[model samples]
Target chain A: MIQVVVNFTERTYNGFMKVKQKLEILADAAKYDASCASSGTEQRNSRNGKGIGSTTGAGICHSYAPDGRCISLLKILLTNFCLFDCVYCVNRVSSNVPRARFSIEEVVQLTLAFYRRNYIEGLFLSSGIIQSPDYTMEQVVEVARILREEHDFRGYIHLKTIPDASPDLLARAGRYADRLSINIELPTAAGLSALAPEKDAGAIRISMAGLRERIDASKDKTASGKCPPRFSPGGQSTQMIVGADASDDRTILTTSADLYGQYRLRRVYYSAFSPIPDASPMLPLQSPPLIREHRLYQADWLMRFYGFEAHEIITSEHGMLALDMDPKTAWAIQNRAMFPVDLNRASKSTLLRVPGLGVRNVQRILTARRVRAVRLDDLVRMHAPVSRMLPFIQLPDYHPGATLDAASLPARLREVPTVPQQLGLFM
Target chain B: MHTVYLEHETDMEGWRYAARQLIRLEVAPQEVSWCVKSAREPGIQGDIFAMPDSRSGSDCSSQEWAISNHAGREVVGISQYHGKTDVTSSTIFPEQLAPSTHADHLMVPRQFIELARSVILHQAPERFYLLYRVLWRLQRERGLMRLAGDADVARLHAMTKSVRRDMHKMKAFVRFREAIVAGQPRYLAWFEPEHHIMAAIAPFFIGRFATMDWTIMSPNMGMNWDGDVLQFLPGGKLEALPAEDDSEVLWLSYYRHIFNPARLKLKAMQKEMPKKYWHNLPEAELIDSMIAEAGTRTQAMLQRAPELPRRKIIGYKRGPQRPDITGGNE
Candidate 1:
């Protein structure tokens, strides 16, 4: 009797320990992909008391990892075992890293447990290809199926779709997930062929096009004027691994522009390549400057919001963005002829081009000018950077004068102190 | 000078009632003072029924207020206070004290009401006075809210922005720990919010975690939901909740592993998840070590020579194969 009791306790301990170990390995493997947004989905709630989750159309960052990334979801892989030998991936078959595979039930339980404790908004499930593309996609979809159907989860779910999966499987994935994404892997086709030989650039594009079509179809009303079944209501997004290849800033931006234009993607995430445990020799030894990734994001935002085209953003002689100043400042310096815009009368698009005036401040200026003349005090009240906008905008109380034509303008603008590259070890 | 004492800090109804009455009396902004009745010193009686003497004529020059309020009858304008009669008897002033003998119109821009709703949640004691001053000016300055350059409007916007941020942070940072109460599972959390937003954010929590039995306790208030109704009670001590749970170990592991050591941006993390929230977060304990070891870890990865390929890389091969029990995908 004593022996049986001890065995029962030991079995339960091992079961719990196994989950902890698997969670550590799988989450570490999946950290390379950088799409953690949980917002912009259909608003849902558990107010009916049938489920235990809700989404407010605005993503909430439940926690921030030490890497400064948003920890909004339980981002993990079903398994860290990959058959494909992608040089940039840590889970390539050749890599000698510890591997783990979570059972479908384990992923469901983990998601519920974390969500119940307010630890995450929902689950972000991705996995390495096992058996075949269909099988792996099936397993990933099954996790969502259980979460949505059996548990009646109403929270956000972002599923990473495999390009090689069938359209039927992808459709089912979209049905269960709030958002779907497929990693573009690399910027250029040649770079992808060289590093990740197994992943087909053509196939990825086709999958994205398919997703776009379905997403569009989902928004249309049927003949009966009834809404069609939802398909990735939050829309599809993709990620490109920056610094993995010799792609320049211009090339990266151009590729992103094409992705946005072609697929109508909600977002194109740029992930700075960091070192892995068993990295390939084919890849660069050092990670690219983190600022490079930051600049790309800034430039990407300009395209999406400020109406700046890709070619116009990278007009500098070098293909790389200037490390000293932001992409907007660089663009403004390059196009000095467009400066000294009138804050009281400039169009919304022109005002958006001003270096320091954000979308919100621009809107405020537009509204304030309607009621009364906008003055320098108005900009100050709006928290607009006075010195930064002085050379770019004209108001009734303040004018750029020769500041826009001054040769020292760029240097003066760049004179702002740069953020330290890294923090001290002990401090 | 007339003083108006509200019942609590977040008494928007009381503030609205008193402001309307003051505006009806044509009381200058400076002549009226706002105070919370409970916050007064001991033995000091709250002037809850203090009403300024009524002016002889309405002189309600605000055309927008008249057009919107005086659609059918002149007496209906005073009846608008009937809905808010439960707030205080002062709101239901005698008809003889009506600002206008014909039509008593006291209305500001709809935008002002929304701004005051958020600004009133701020912890600043001067918030009520600022709001009242803005309301008094809005009656005259129809486009006052649009003039962002005005000091009162700027202060209102700033206070509203702070309250909204506090509410958002409360939503983002509240961490629940699982516990058993009366042999039933319940999730409990303790947070210290910067403003009087406990009631404002309760609906969000209730809507999200409706099916579960949970309670979010702060220093001043507690919100409890038990699958059916949400109840607001007085705050409780942190000791009443569990310090840790079994799931925390898993959460900490996920936090540690998900962090990319090569790219440490402590500033970015701290900016979003400030030090004030670190104590309540279970994963914050790992941040220091993660930062300390990041440089060494990245350096080691950079210095370590790449291992030779174990086998000649094979092209994509598709087949059905059982997953390796111990490790690899094959």
Candidate 2:
């Protein structure tokens, strides 16, 4: 009787510790990734009494972490064990961080449980390369496959794909995942090779190009007009580590613009390098360039939405974005000659270049002007920042006057330090 | 002067009936007052007892008073009981009143109707009066909505925006806790909303969580789904439902673990999930401890030295086999 009781206690303790340790290790290992978005997928729901979740066109942030990042998905690694020696990755084989691997069942149960509680939209399953990239890829895809097919979970699933995995494996991954991303890791091939010796930049691009082709083919219909099977209907996205290597903001933007054009990517996430537990002797021991990351996102918005080219936005001599001011305001001040853009006569593209007027306000202006002349009060009523707009735009009742030429324009344009300018709130 | 009492706070049909009658009677918007039957207005209540004096020959008949009261309206007297005959005077029917009317004759924009539908859901005592005022003005001013700067149009837009925001918040914040009801799994959630939006937002939850049995309770209303049909319940003080479950345990675990100690943007997190919501969220219990430990954890990571590498534990051998995509068919 004594022996049986002791064994039972021992087994319970081990089981409890193993799951808790695994969660701590795996979640810590996965936190460096910046992509927690669960948006831009095909809208689906399980209203037929078959499944338990739904995905709308726009994703909802179930919670917000103190990192200011959204917690829309239960982002985690299938396992933290790795064979690759990516120096920047805390999960890299060379690192001394304690490792753990979650069983496939644990992952599925965790996702479903978290989802049922409305803690998450779905799973974003990633893994460190274990055994081989192919083996690791298969393990990751199996989690998604089980959640989608066996459980009939109609929620968002974003799988991180290994570029080295076989095309066949990639194809199957596309079938199950709403989104697939392969990290570019670094901006330049030299930077990538120097830091992550095992990763090949060429191979990553090849996989991206392959993914894009398959994504495009799936979207196209055959001559019979039959729709092809859905393959990543949410499209593809990629992430690049900003401060880990020697690449500057200009280089990063160039790579991002290229990726957006080449891969038809939905988003390019910039993750500022967070120093991990074990220090790399060669990397800089400074604060993570968070402001730089924020500015890059702003610059990216300009490129995608405002029609600003990558070459035009970079102002600092070092090819780095200005830390104090937003890229749009910096560009507007740099080209002061384009100031006092006539709100009545300026084209959509020119109006978009204004610092304060966002894409929505500009569209509203164009639409409203067709009906009647837009005054300053009309702009204010639309909730446009009149203080920011007064320096750059001319309305029927108001103009910049001499303020456009004032030397304090840059200081005035600079965002007040205390206020948090949320990036996507304007649009 | 005229008084129209609505049967329900959010009763659009009742509102439309009163509006059409008032317009037909040539009663200008300022000449009429609109109040809900259940609204807590003492003046409206006193107006009901005062109605007996306006009756022609009845000796304070309680039945006549009951019909006249309609939760209290002084001007709408015993004639309310004999409605179709007593109130239908040729003078009450304007020359423009036609059984079949054109949309152009109303001159109210389709936009104003959409705005009114959302605005009427608001709990403001003046909402009905404000909407009627806008509708009355729209007939004279065709381009009223186009003036986004106009106070009435702007107020209309503001109310609609507030209701829409509440609906979106409901969509984002409702957290369901799994419970066993009748030996079957049912999800229960409690939410506090600032507006009368439970009816407006229930269909979204029904459509989303259709397969699962669930109940969403708010201060104003409650909605329940039983796999096939959805039912509404009058809401009061919410009884403490099952607050903890195995699923919530894992959810809280994930929440505690997923937060990065390095980045502490408390303002941003609070901006989205305000402290008011933090009380109900299972994960929110971890937030204070997470914030407290974040700085120290970040410092420790920053200060830790490069430890000597441990012997790597070998997992699967990289065999000659490539991952077969065809394997998925099974």
Candidate 3:
């Protein structure tokens, strides 16, 4: 059995005990979660003098962490205590990490103070499973209720929903939260069974289906023409830990595609499994597959916005994405016949599939071409990465020549070593 | 050679009046130059040289005739020629022009107006001239604004983009520090913007931080709000704000702890949160140290052997028990 030494030098602040210590513990526990997005919420403001904060439609990142992660919301767990001993999790009951819990009032106060100082858009509250699922869920709901009803805080609140919690509690959570998420934890059911044995895959899906029903019902008007109560207008999102098990890139993306289609999830965050202190013997001791995780995110973006199917992106023999090159470039190289898309005449969909033409630049080409023919100079002025696109696109003044059919095309299309490799050794 | 001096820096009304008069008089764009009466040189009033004879009320045709007759000459107007400039008399071809010329003939598209809104907030001295130039050409070529490839339209778009970027940075970079005035909490932020965009971007701040009393101070102007009322103050300096505050300590703590040393994408980080903003942000001070120590920290994590898995300290009795596996816990 793991024995935790309670080593917190108990500090006091205005008769409140361990406030700073609890913040440290809880914030550390919450860091493992990858969902830091505060965007895509219902736009609101406290213009009426009734509330204390506002939420923009597209959320703002108040700060960027050294990891290049956005610090948009005050992401913290209610407590680090847990009943499940999930091996990948830092706060599993088996771990010897320090434990602390924030009283409902402390979370509310911290959220308000951080918001007042313009440090964050709003709160992103999650918790480890503790007590009974219902009891633990009730405590989480109370925090949101207090923030919403008691203080009229009209800020973005993202609550992590317990899959096993009752429908009433889930509905109550949806009412107060702008976005709600239930982490699928691992990609496959077998992975979940092996790593986080306590979590049920079927239960998670059932809960998602129920939440989707409520979300859809709330979006429409009733028969009497009365508006339904707002329910997670920012919609639901989920996270899947990447490189945690034998699940390959194809499997991970397939799971994400399924989640998006079934639950209509706003996002599926791919968290690279990072090494933790008090690590499990079963888990790999190597460095996290950060590059693989990044590739999966790029592939996910293709599936969501670029009309790429999960199978189309992972057409590699090993069912893995190329870590050295981006998925789009890899795809374009694999399908050499689809090269040299005419920038002037290609459809929006075809332009989107081009290696380096981003959605913004493609739209720019469409708009600019309406008045005059798009030329090389126009694309350069638009700041499109012309070198990356030049191999795959044809303009009035530019053509790929024999470059598209060349045997050395893949190597040519590869990202040039702009930064030296020694620095990458450390990263 | 007609230098039409506007009243103030962002005097769109003055620009509108001068443009209408000059366009009606059939004055070519190259013949006119737009000037704003500098704050130091407050010699005249009523949009200064706009209607040279100082017609204040609605009509400007009498002064328009004066401008046409005195072309290529300095026309100085004060508050002296109020109500004297007739609207109908200044046109180069008075009867041939449609009756709705003033109200409609010179009407630029809505896109031009929106573009002009951002363009006027630019600090470029030629912004007014460029806008009027486009406006003049727009009368003959109705589809001119649609051509982004055109140099004049492209310049207008570039100005709009710069102003838009400035506004976006103002929104992103303004970091409020907590202060107390009259025993109630107030927030103050200092930002350095590249354009005359304080008035243009103040509404976003007002709407976002509506309940709190806040002030967003910039070099050119300052915006203040006290829960209910939003107002503007004159320009301020960086010294106007305190260097540090209490809330920043916690904010910095959060920034430091949230950063994961293992994934250091410095180029990407610097792309969004550039080094130019480093001096203002409290968390930016830790960035250098974090990047420096990341190698050692990640190395330690990588080289360290996996610790033995800790046995469960607490258990949920109702949940599944351990299945018959080497390490599986149910």
Candidate 4:
């Protein structure tokens, strides 16, 4: 009797600790993925009181980690054990990190529990290749299926797709997921071969192309005017590890631009390569400047929203974005003839190119100019960066004059330090 | 002077009805004042029941008067009403000057209504007065609201923005703790919002957690949803909630492990999740330690010697048969 009681207690204790241990190891393994978006999904609510949760177009960041990333989803992996020997990956087969895997039920329960507590927008499920790519992909999709069908969960779901997974598994993943992503891993094919030898560059492109075609077909009407089944209604996105390869900003942006155009990708996340434990010799010992990642995001935004082409943003002989200034300001300085834009008469596109005018502020300026001439005071009220815009814009009450022609324009407008700041106590 | 009193801070219907009467009476914005009567305030405890007799000439029915009297304990003033036997006689228009019956016909832009709806929830004492002033000006200056450069319009926008942000934050930060109430599971949360946004944000929670029984408590208000209906109740002390849940251990573990020590932008994190909301958040307690140890942890990772490949190379090459690429399963 005593032995049976002891065994029972031990089993329960281990079972409880197993989940906690797996969560820590798996979540730690998955943290390197930078894509945490849970927005732009179809609007849903549990108003019928049948299920639990809602997604109202706009994503909510339930918490912000100390790393400054949005904890919008319960971003976790199915397992941290892998078969591939990716040099940069902490969970690569050869790496010495501790490994753990969660059963599908554990993931489902964790997602629903955390979601009910309003701790996350939804689940972002990714996994390392466990057996075959097909088996791993099936496990990831099964979690989403149970969340959607069994529990009637209507919240946002983002699944990190395995590019080498069978096409049928990819289709099922899209059906259950609001967004699906296949990480491009590196900017260039050479980078992939050097870093992640097992990952095929051609296979990644084929998967992306397949996703694009299905997404397009889902949007189209059939002969009877009936729409096809939903397939990643929020569309596809990808991530590329920055500074892991010798690719320049030009190459990165060029890849992103091509992905955006060719695959109709919703976003291309750029994660600056951060150092990991059990380091590999092939990887860099130090991380790229965090600001480099910030600059890349700004340049990516310029390409997406600000109507600047990738080549136009990075036009220097070194094929690099200015570390001292923003890509927009650098472009403005390089092509000074385009500036001194009239605030009152400038087109929306012209206003968007102004160094200090953001999309919303430009709209505000346009609205205010319709009633009366926009003055310096008006720009200040609109929260436009007056000093930054003084050289590039011509307000009705103010003009650039000699400021635009100053030889030290670049030096004067440089906001960030050219040299990277030392990683201090609190960066 | 027109002294119009509202029931509470977020009394939009009362404000609209009173403002429509004042606008019809041709009262200028400066001639009007707005005030809220809290239960703690002295005077006018008995006057609420007696005032309906003075407005006998007006079209306010006895039933409406009864409803307003029952709900008018927390009163807001449009003009100052001193303690007097006949306060309404001197407070509003004369008995002969009846409010126009066509008050609903008074028109403002749809934009003004949307702006006022958000602005009314602002904690500013003068929010109602500013809204009325804008409405009075809009009667003649039809394009007044469109001029974002105008000071009054800009202030309105700023207040609206603040209230909207407060609402959004309330939604983002209300962390629920599970508790057993009457042998059933119930989720409870505590939040302190900067604005009177409880009623405004109630629908969002209702839509999100419709099937779950949950309650969200603020300092002044509380919301409860029992699977089918949502009810507003008086707020309670934080002691009423569970101190912790077992699941929080897993959540904290996930929070701690997921944070990358290499990139610590405390400012960016603080910008979205400000320190004001730290005490209620269970994971917030880990932030200081996480940040304090970040630099050392990163240095360790960077300085750690690269390990040699230990495992044999498992070259699982793809076979000649490619995976089927046919698009749809159906």
Candidate 5:
């Protein structure tokens, strides 16, 4: 059991600074981790708005982590201060951004304040590799241990792990956190060597593998046959800096698929890299296509939930995902030879391939089709934007065998990126 | 103290409706108490009793007098909920739509409920609302990323409470009940939701009852006239009703199924929907035990062990699969 508080040499460094200045410094530094979920726990106020509780905040934004759970997390870093220079990161030791560190008490205090005020439902906490991996990991575990044992808090918590943390520290973290993520930093081992020279990919994997072992070990039932203390019960997730490496969607997706198959990871977050505030000409001044990030998410979803394989959707000729039309639509246009699949007899997987047919819509069609053949009007009722699917699917009465076109599909759907290459938005 | 806007039914308010019934009970003048607050408050903390403006014949009759004497003038947004309870139930009032307690200082009029029910489902700038909520979810909830060190769950708990401060107006005040008028039964309810949701959600009721003529009353607000124009009213009091109950079972069935299974994370679910709310709603009975025994039940289901369904499986499936209920949410 954790003691109520850790008796640190209580340090109070007050910056007679304005809140906005502090926010500007903190928020700018906090970017990088991505896990925005306000779900998994719901508690309301007792009466008269008298107590501290809320189910009222906007909880969880659905972004795909690699294993493709619409992983939501409170993605922020503990402080921008770093002792190592990892090129892909803005918070690298050499960078000149202003840095601030939150005391564990202050951090805990802020989370509860925000929670009671209905600003958030959970905490996603990550930090720069401070003092040492073991020390930093210990501080992180202490927070979780205290939150659980001291406050009896049952809210969702996701921790961004430090590489090279001790096995004992990781095991303790598993007890309080709902999910733990160890950023791969970049895709290939060569990329890590070139960019973050001090970072070791092997060590990172070893930590992840260690986490997996402890998580597995904790699941061993207690002597009474009850489940032992939980270990990241929400499961493990990781992030990959999208544009930092030469990896394309296919390569990235292939790696993601392998990670999912091997680690049984809950998600893989693809964060499109943004140029650091300071100069580094070795890195591209231009941001990677943010829409590419969006497309990657779509393709990722398809592979995980919609039954599309990696190669079927990504061909060499179409080296990247289509910027204008969705990858699924583009795939349909290219595979016109398979067009006009009969909606009446199509399987759930085939129906999912049809544009405008979401999983929910597919379920509706499957159930409805069993009772009666679906006509275009019934499809309309299903809110299946028939125009999008019409060119691809064959309804009961209409068949468009001649309309399929594999040759012009690519040229018809090229799109220009919308924002600064980072995330497709001008801002 | 909260800023409330009390609404009245053109015909009756919870006050008038209950006054008529209290006229039937005879007892020694016992001081009566009524508690009320925006549905958002905790632990029934906002309850206030009003002693009537004057006593009728006896102590039991002072139910209204007691309520008004306590806090008749202080309550605001005292809108109506349309649900009804059996008269024999111990408390004469429920936070439901029907006014068991006849204190206007505490309860909303039926018309306020009608207006509220009319627009509860109308769409609004949900994204704008969502954007605000997302930020709260981030800084306030998950903490600005605490992986390398300590996390602050308490801070997250505090920030999440303020996000939906306005939703309480709908939950405590929504009044749904069945009533008959001009020889046909109409399912009607009243509420005082802040945003213009009536136009969006009324269709849910309309989709269910395309042929019925019912008015939803929201105080100092508007009401929906069946297939016609919306009716608006200001501050309101009490009235009585000749009522109906034809389609309640279908509504109950629909409510039972709207829950998402994959997202059935109870903490998340409870955070979005509080337990105090269960007392006033009909479906609470189905979920309460499920919530209490949630972990054990979940493990049992996962193990394919013999845990029972929420209710006995008499072999009936429920769905809101009407073909006309076409649109899905964003």
Candidate 6:
């Protein structure tokens, strides 16, 4: 059994007493969750009906990190203490980080307070397994349950999944949470066991597969106008801790490729390893390069928004992404034979592969292309970055293939490396 | 927009296309806050009319599209990105374009004002959304019979058109200086609005350059700097700011200093400042050459360009400004 510090036996179990400390510990623990993006929801507060808030997303969302991504949710963890010492966790039961816990009431209070203050649009809560999976699961579920049924907090709530917890508890959790996530520690089952001994990879998969089935079933019921029961209205998401284990970039990306195919997840966050205290001998001494995390995000964008597949990205030594250039650019440079694709005629999938074009840009091209044959001027009119995109794309008005030779393509694409972290002050 | 909402999802494609056209027509209402998300499949889950697609008005389809194949799906002139009610609607166009009004019900007079302009002038699709909205409310609220008449609508339309022209000039002509006079960074830019309404937009520039001692030089209509003085251009040549001076070299240097090559989104940048504007400013030549050689110069965005050798003393001349007579006061 795990222990609570400052002996709560003397103070009693009423959660409100520890409400302040709960916010501190829980918020820190939740920061590592990568699935807080608020890009795609429209649900609002039923000011008249049983709810106190809304879920319409807004602003730079604290994301758009150096790599231009948004940190969307009020991302935080429930408690960092744990009985099962995951090697990569800074707050593992074996590690020396300060720890705290909130009773269900305390968590509910913090979320309501924060929501009322307009600090976050929603709450994303995860926890370190304390005492038992069942025990931690019970606490996390109650917070969501009370928020929905009692407080009528209708805002987005993304709850972390306890893989081995019971179906009964998990099902109740799905009822209130906008989304649920289970960290697939690394790409493969063996990697999971090696880094996190107590965690069961098979159990994790079973839970994910079960969540998928429930999400699909509920979606069907809702579409048919049955309202059978709202189950994960925002759907399921997962995260993989990159570089914690000896997994190569190809292996990690391949794992993501498989998960997307299998689970129908809304997203998969790639959290690069943060070195833990009293770290295991098997783990590396340092955190992976922040660039690796960035490259992975770019690669992830390729798969989701840009349309690149696993085999297209997997390379030999680099295996994943080049630290300096994005995966798409690196791929383009390697496949010089495919240069100067005619933007007017290229398929939507092909247009997306060009470095400067985003999903929205591709859609615009499709819309504009149908109206008239697109010219280089049209690309500029559409606000497509002709600078980066010029060499790769062949427009009706201009062509760079004749001028840009292979020997100098690298120089043409180079820029002084500006770390994204330094740009935070302006925003 | 309301009819489209009531129509089945499969039959609303035409409605969607029309809405995009209407949205692009408006000059302002900056950005409409659409609920790009829906809780339902096909990703649209809310009541269609209430989904913040366009302005709140009488369902035009009831009168106009009554003959369409589907009775539903005629969402015209409704604010889509905001919400069902005026209280929550995010007008798709900027505030300068789509001014907020009572969101829930139609103010018919504004609609008439808009309808009048469209019929009278055959307004382009881009400007029609705003005029339509203005005229519709005028008709509803002020009474259709009491319209300021055909002359009034024409005058308002012309006013709106001038505002549009001036905004483009403000974006292009507004310049800033980097030279420090005394302890402060002195800045200035020149403009020549055809309408001569520099005073109306001075606040925007003031808010943006809150810390600088700046002057905005307009040809024939002067705008001077210095706290105690507000001097107008004592009428000069109509061709304003047409010459090359050394200051542009320093301006481009400051611009290059802040350009983060890591986050270069050329389309976004060019969308804000197009290439055509590059000719008048000295920096334009350098930027045009750089962008032209984009394929090869992606690596060294800054160093690749020759830098202005650091000057030992501050430059305070550009055909000369009224120098501060502060020595006499001291």
Best by TM-score: 4
Off by over 4 Å in 5: A1-23, A39-75, A216-224, A406-427, B1-330
lDDT winner between candidates 2 and 5: 2
> What lDDT does the true structure give each of the candidates?
0.82, 0.76, 0.77, 0.83, 0.50, 0.56
lDDT of 6 by residue, A307-389 (tens): 78987875446675777677887788777778778877999888888878888768767765664667776566555677888
- In candidate 5 the C-alpha lDDT for residue B92 amounts to 35
Instruction: List runs of model 3 lying over 4 Å from the truth.
Output: A1-17, A222-224, A416-427, B24-29, B38-103, B308-312, B317-330
> lDDT tens string, model 1, A93-172?
88888889999999999999999998999999999988789999999999999999999999999999998887789989
Q: Score the docking of each candidate (DockQ).
A: 0.37, 0.32, 0.28, 0.42, 0.02, 0.02
Per-candidate TM-scores read: 0.89, 0.86, 0.86, 0.90, 0.54, 0.55
Best by DockQ: 4
lDDT tens per residue, model 2, A1-427? 1232244467765664577678778888888889988888888888774777788878888887777778889888999888877778888777888889999988888888777767778889899987789889999989998998998988889999998888778998999999999999899999988988778787788788888888888888974489887788888898999888878899999999999999899999998887788866667787555888889999999999999999999987899898888999899889989989999899999999999889887887776677678888887787778887788888878888998899988887676463455653565
TM-score of chain A of 2: 0.93
Runs of candidate 1 exceeding 4 Å displacement: A1-8, A222-224, A415-427, B39-104, B309-315, B318-330
Candidate 3 on A140-207: residue-level lDDT in tens? 89999998999888888999998887777888999999999999989999999899988888778877
Tens digits of per-residue lDDT, candidate 3, B1-330, equal 455666556667667777776666556666665655443112223343343343232221112212222234333221112233553333221112223333556767888999998888787777877787788778777767776656678789899998988787667678888767789878888888878777777677777778778988876567788877767676688887865665566666667766777788887788778888888887898899989998888787667666554553655554443232112233
- The fraction of reference interface contacts (C-alpha pairs within 8 A across chains A and B) present in each candidate is 0.71, 0.48, 0.46, 0.70, 0.00, 0.01
Taking chain A of model 6 alone, its TM-score versus the true chain A equals 0.87
Q: Write the per-residue lDDT of candidate 5 for residues A231-335, one digit (tens) a residue.
A: 876678888888877877777888778777666777787877754455344565556755677788788888888999888878547467777778888787767
Q: Least lDDT summed over 10 consecutive residues: which range in candidate 4 chain A?
A: A1-10
Instruction: Please say which candidate is ahead in TM-score: 3 or 4.
Output: 4
lDDT of 2: 0.76
- Order of candidate numbers by lDDT, starting with the best: 4, 1, 3, 2, 6, 5
